[model samples]
Target: MNSCPFQRARSPEQKAERRAQILEAAALFFAEQRFAAISLAAIARQSGVTKAALYRYFPSKEALFLALYLSELDAMVEAPLPQEGPAWAAISELLIARPLFCRLTSILHTVLEHNLDESQAREFKQALLACFAQLAARLQRDFALEGDQAIRFLMQVQQSVIGCWAVSQPAPVVASVIKAPPLDVFQVEFGDALRTQLRALQAAL
Candidate 1:
């Protein structure tokens, strides 16, 4: 096996590049295959680094996975929210354009299904909640929703998004699982139902 690229100290630029490569490889691997089936050795090989080098950057597979997960969260927060439209438009744009939102949900589901340790699981939950809270705050501020109603609405939206993404059915079966009377009878509709629900909330408010 090749050594980890991070095993030796290098210039800041080189180190940054190597870490980015490892993260890129990890993300691709996670997306392409089951997280439980992937091994650190495979990641190291995919990254063109030895196990030791991979370890130097990420001490274990879990650490690497968590790092990737956190990176995804950071990306979501840093991504541009729609600036030129009403709050609802901005929220819709964010839901549709932010790859990290979906990716993070997918990762969280994988971690939960695979039975990660308590600490890891808790961290993932906290990160997910934090993302939701950030979205809720933004909505409240930009849309002028206030008080308990805003909080309740945010919670509902958060749950709706999580339910939409975290469910494991094939695309065709998602509608049955959701079973909302007004939702269209289609599976895996991406942002459609969420947008509709949010629009309803806006209309009510």
Candidate 2:
């Protein structure tokens, strides 16, 4: 018997649940559409929450998407980096298997992070640094590298993924043009480029 215009005020647990529900809906949208093209209103519509209620949890669409990105980053930190087989293939396989995560990586720094406020940005970056530390530790365990060296390698691989995703993901016309055998030299498959870069890094190390 509680009634409010936007929605009844939520308990802390309910708030967290609502936040997660919004994130799940937003993830599906991001998977289907480009990150820059999606709006907060669309996300709220998909999540079945009013815009005001959604704002209560996320503050902004960028913040919400950043949360999704960070969640995926945490999962990556937990998952072991490729130990056996071609390192490039392993890296590409891992990224391709989680296409949404891979897609968001290309926009996280430039678009999503750029729109956030200082406080929110700091909070997210702090969590990211922790994830990076976890990744470095994991890499050191599996590869013959020092802590700093492991972090350097991981950072390079991260940069390669972002760059490759950007160059390889194109519009329909561009993609069609790139498919021609003569233009193959200009064509770029993100996973393949990522894999090649990763393999080179592995070879060096």
Candidate 3:
């Protein structure tokens, strides 16, 4: 028999709220900490739920991370994108507003994207593809681009964001250098880099 922790969920809304609470806690932790360094127990504590109850919402830490990523995508989907200089501007604005989201992208390929079973990985990949596809389709409308062009544009956007994130998020010493005079010129802003790439792509196309 399953044991309920704290209190049993009496309604579907309660269940959903509980799940959202866990996800919110996890996302806040990920924003402030490294992906590999965060633990499910920590998330349970932060969410004010028992470890057993946290497991009821997310089977593992990676699953929780996946949920966080999905929430990020949902935010992007909800935004009303205007056509004028929108792609880069919109994405850059998003990264600026949620810098932790950019950090997650930097780790996605190397860390959080791995260490999963085939089935789970497939599920995550499908959701990722869907997000990319939706973004690309919207780009098609905005740029009046072909299907392939839309996808390629999105790929470039991801690469720019990831690369800029890596460059901008340096160690203590490097970060200091990046923020100082002279060296500050070398600081890479993800938003600017993304906008530059889009402009270049527009010129090329």
Best by lDDT: 2
Superposed by TM-score, candidate 1 places the C-alpha of residue 7 at a distance from the truth, in angstroms, of 6.5
Local lDDT at 113 for model 2:
88
Q: What is the per-residue lDDT of model 2 for residues 1-205, given as tens digits with 9 covering 90 to 100?
A: 1123345346888777677778888988887887778888878877778888788878888888889998888777666567786544555677777777878888877888887778998999898888888877766666556887777877787888888888888788988888878886778877678888888887776
**Candidate 2 or 3, higher TM-score?**
2
| Residues 31-138, model 1: lDDT tens digits | 777677888888878777777888888766766777786776676656666656565566666766754545555555545325457776687668766765676666
Most TM-score-accurate candidate: 2
The lDDT of model 1 is 0.66
Please give the distance, in angstroms, between residue 201's alpha carbon in candidate 1 and its true position after superposition: 5.5
lDDT, residue 106, candidate 2: 85
- For residues 1-205, what per-residue lDDT tens digits would candidate 3 score against the true structure? 1223567556899888888888888888877787878999888877778889888877788778877877887677566676676455655675567675677777777877776889989999898888889877887787577788777767776777778778767788887767878779878766677667666765565
lDDT of 3 at 86: 48
Note the residue pairs that clash in candidate 2: none
The global Cα lDDT (0 to 1) of model 3 is 0.75
TM-score of 1: 0.64
